[model samples]
Target: MTVIKNAELTAGNSFTQNQALGLLTELVPVSLNNINGREIQTTSAKKLHAYLGVGRDFSNWIKGRIEEYGFIYEQDYINFDSPNLANQSTESVQIKQWKTKRGGDRRSKDYCISLGMAKELAMVERNEQGRAVRRYFIQCEERLQHIAPQDVRKLRDQLKARITAANDFKPMCAALELARAEQGKLTQAHHYTSESNMIARLVLGGLTAKRWATGNGISGDPRNSMSADQLKHLSYLEQSNITLIELGWDYHQRKTELTRLSQRHLAKQLEVAND
Candidate 1:
């Protein structure tokens, strides 16, 4: 039999876990663990035990619960004691060695129970903390269920298509600007170059497209490296520039208007995110 040392199991600190925690209730932190190429929502058994204020030793309590409920290994929970941990990333399962009462280092037996197992365990406890945590788990499940992974992927693909379509209009607008310059006898090769630089500067914080690509070590357009939000904002600015060009606004006038528009759009975005 393996001796279960009294040590706290560290919660996952990965970005996915942190982001989920921020969105869900933080009463009991959860993690997304990769098992056999699939991600599972799990929580630390030790943390759950501590949160429940159980009177029995953690090892005995967990073992008794598993045996009593007939919880299957690797299906309901995962034990970190196995040598298989060598194949996993540290971020996936955070395990740490601790000093024992005898001043010796030992790795504790840590278990990560699935959300289903966790809810069942909490329900069996029949206490206020258990009830509260069970409800929290239910809420987390409902929220996650609303945004399935496939749905998110589909939405992202749609956004990419929209951005690409928006990009195609920019060149057409540039040709319109060239024609307008010719009619006004202000035709200059540098006009098109300056207009492109202005859009890059407005969207990328003063970095020209070439400068941004070089700075990020990108071989092509820097838009490919931009976040979804940045790309959407870039699309909006491009359309705005196209309109200003049609309205016969000079380069300096359009630059001033675009700067103000970008600032206002960013402020609105921040406000909406906060709300």
Candidate 2:
């Protein structure tokens, strides 16, 4: 009889990306709130709670899997389900990763393995070319910038709704990078990269990989782990080698930096393996 090693795994298994997504989704109904100065108020927070419900349903399912099988570190604010790879004589594996940073001049997937495993994926992609995302925010922010607190709250709600709609839209970006180098000298080579690729690469540089996710769980603003839109971008940023935290996002509506890496994860792959 065939056997599955993890068949016995249950809710108590540990925390994982899938479990975490589920937990967060379940919390959406109770999570919405607003950023007030530095404090989170009940009224403003309600909108986000709603987003956690229907919008990020996909992400929520992923989180649920993590929360179920992975171990949750509330204090560390991180959860890990995969076995630690700190010590092991590893063999080659066709691991897929995102291009966290541009590899100086190398081609062929630029960089991979920057973002974590697939469960971290989110359906919300960047804004398409023709649509205007900031257009709505730009006008709204200006209109409410100097209004009274109560009045600002009203406008914020309107902006929030627009942001939600924008999240569902597929935004286009200018990709400008060699899709991949030619087999030989480019005496004759079709351009593989597009404007969308270039922009995708740049934006990937700002994402938050799994290793950096919990530690950087949307800083500054406790009002959000990361906004729904930002989370969506980062989710799509998965294969791009960026994480949500890496992108210039407003955790507390403030830009935050991710932890530095001592070396590229792909370095090992490029290294001369002792055959």
Candidate 3:
């Protein structure tokens, strides 16, 4: 049995590119609303409640999850008054009620969470409906971004850019440095580094960063001396390892999964690259 070091599975957002594609297949077009003067896509708590088939008292459930997960109020969700309310006094007041259905009850204030937060909430919800809702959120993201998976290079570049923009290269460098810190650590704890090299060989024309840099006569920190293409492949490996770690995969399990994913990605890239 593989022993997961940090098995707090609740930490990961649990979203993936393949799952995002699956979500895109099930999407229904809806007009996205604006938030704070920016056009944004969001799903209401009421809609999610109905979709999830949770009981009518979903407000309590939503509140529970929001508080439990420490989801930021303005960032993850927002409460606002309904403009369609009949009472002028009520209209002026910030009411946060949602109708259970289209014409159901407007008993309380309505809460709206971003699609991303919805996916995270769904991961913890652990029900079939919750899974479906998570897919919907991924679909929302795909549609919003206009993702085209057929273009492998384009997609890889986009993911690489997004990961790079969101995270400092320090994490990637740190992971590499940690891998080289000790041979035992590399072979045992950081086995994913080996799989990463395997993936890099296929995608980068049979060359890992260190090997490539050495062959080209570059000295010191092959990671720092990587070409753009080599860096992108390294980024993908780093992301794979990070995702596995976040999902609470044990060291060995992560290595196995990383190997499989890297091989799969390499195959896909080959198909597209050859086309």
TM-score of each: 0.41, 0.18, 0.36
Model 2, 20-134: lDDT tens digits are 3343333321211233221221111122212223334433544553465462222112323322111121332323531223322212210011011111221122221101212
Q: Give the TM-score of candidate 2.
A: 0.18
**Residue pairs in steric clash, candidate 1?**
none
lDDT of each model, Cα atoms only? 0.67, 0.29, 0.56
> How many residue pairs clash in model 2?
61
lDDT (Cα) of model 3: 0.56
Model 2: per-residue Cα lDDT at residue 229: 36
lDDT of 3 by residue, 91-179 (tens): 24344643333444444566777666777866775765566557666666676566534443443454465457237344644564455
Model 2 stretches astray by more than 4 angstroms: 1-39, 43-205, 209-212, 218-275
